[model samples]
Target: MNRYKHRAYNEELMDDLTAGGPSMDQTLRELETINRWLGGNFVTIDGLVKLLKKSPSRPLVIADLGCGGGDILKLVARWASKKKLEVELVGFDANPHIIEYAKENCKEFKNIRFEVQDIFSEEFKQREFDIILCTLFTHHFTEKQLTGIFRQFKSQAKIGVVINDLHRHPLAYHSIKLLVNLFSKSEMVKNDGPLSVLRAFKRKELVQLMNDAEIDRFTLQWMWAFRWQLVF
Candidate 1:
């Protein structure tokens, strides 16, 4: 399976709503390590920093969609502290189990909160945030779904939306597959690691998605380890 080819629809094991407990906890924790090791978290951080530069003053609200375990939010909290930025952060996950886990994982941050909200729902559409973030999350949906989701984000976010996801390369797929197989114990990570690359976006595909979403102002940068940092 080449990433240059059409995206793979084969679902990742973690996509299952029923997945949880030790296996899910292990997968989430391992994912935190994997993202940190890959320098993946910084891609999202850079995008947020770009938006923050536009409006350094004024307290802001940031919403992280599909925030698994709220690991990225922790980094955001730390960054906010250093910058002395007054920011209110909230995390949203479709899975209630994941939401519950994220609450405990990010309990130290008094400025952060978590909620179980499906992106497609009316309640989510009604809510607005200054900056919306989706880190390694867009790949889970199809092109059509993403087009709609991006459109919603354009409406929901007052500043912009930050999207950090995979670049869809064969090396990314194979390397993650090998790395997870070598070091990961969770079955979900073992199955989802490679599958995510196959499901990820190409530059042209992302451009098409942006065009379809009617988003004209944006920046797309390819980052280290085959990651895409798209801020719109």
Candidate 2:
């Protein structure tokens, strides 16, 4: 079977988000470097900058779904500080262990905090954010799951959403496999890096997903390093 023909069912080590320790910590650290070097981090930042243009006044609340180690939130925090934009940034993940680690990782930023939130839960739905971000997230679920998630996100985000996720392609798969093998010592990072590409979305799939969720106003652009920047 051609695994790339569909979202791969193969599980990644990061799937068990509850499992965290030195290895997961190392994985988080390495991912930060990879994202920064590959220019992936800027995708989210730029999307946010556009949203910021709409409303420069008042404090904005931003929540990151499936936030890993809170590194992205740290970037958002820094940007807000520099721009003098007051933002209450919250990083949400279902994994308590990861949330704990993220909390520790972002201790220096007083305005940023971490929370354990299941995106589909009632508790999550009741809460609202000015902008919701899902960086390298959303690909972890199947089509049905994402459709439902889109609905939830639309309801929760007061402003809009910024999604930075992988694009399923051969080059992305092979390139990540090669890069991880060369620099990663953690087995989880080595195995999951390539698998993530296999589980990512294609542009057409994203369009269909948006239609299903009744989301009409949105911009979907392909980014360098094989990523999709979907801003809604």
TM-score of each: 0.97, 0.97
Clashing pairs in 1: none
RMSD of 2: 1.1
- Give the residue spans of candidate 1 off by over 4 A: 1-3
Task: Write down the RMSD of candidate 1 (Cα, Å).
Answer: 1.1
Give candidate 1's whole-model lDDT: 0.92
Candidate 2 wrong stretches, greater than 4 Å? none
The top-ranked prediction according to lDDT is: 1
Error of 2 at 175 (Å): 0.6
Estimate, for each residue in 157-190, the C-alpha lDDT of model 1 and write its tens digit.
Answer: 9999999999898889889999999999998999
- Clashing residue pairs for model 2: none
Tens digits of per-residue lDDT, candidate 2, 133-191, equal 99998889988989999988888888889999999999899999999999998898998
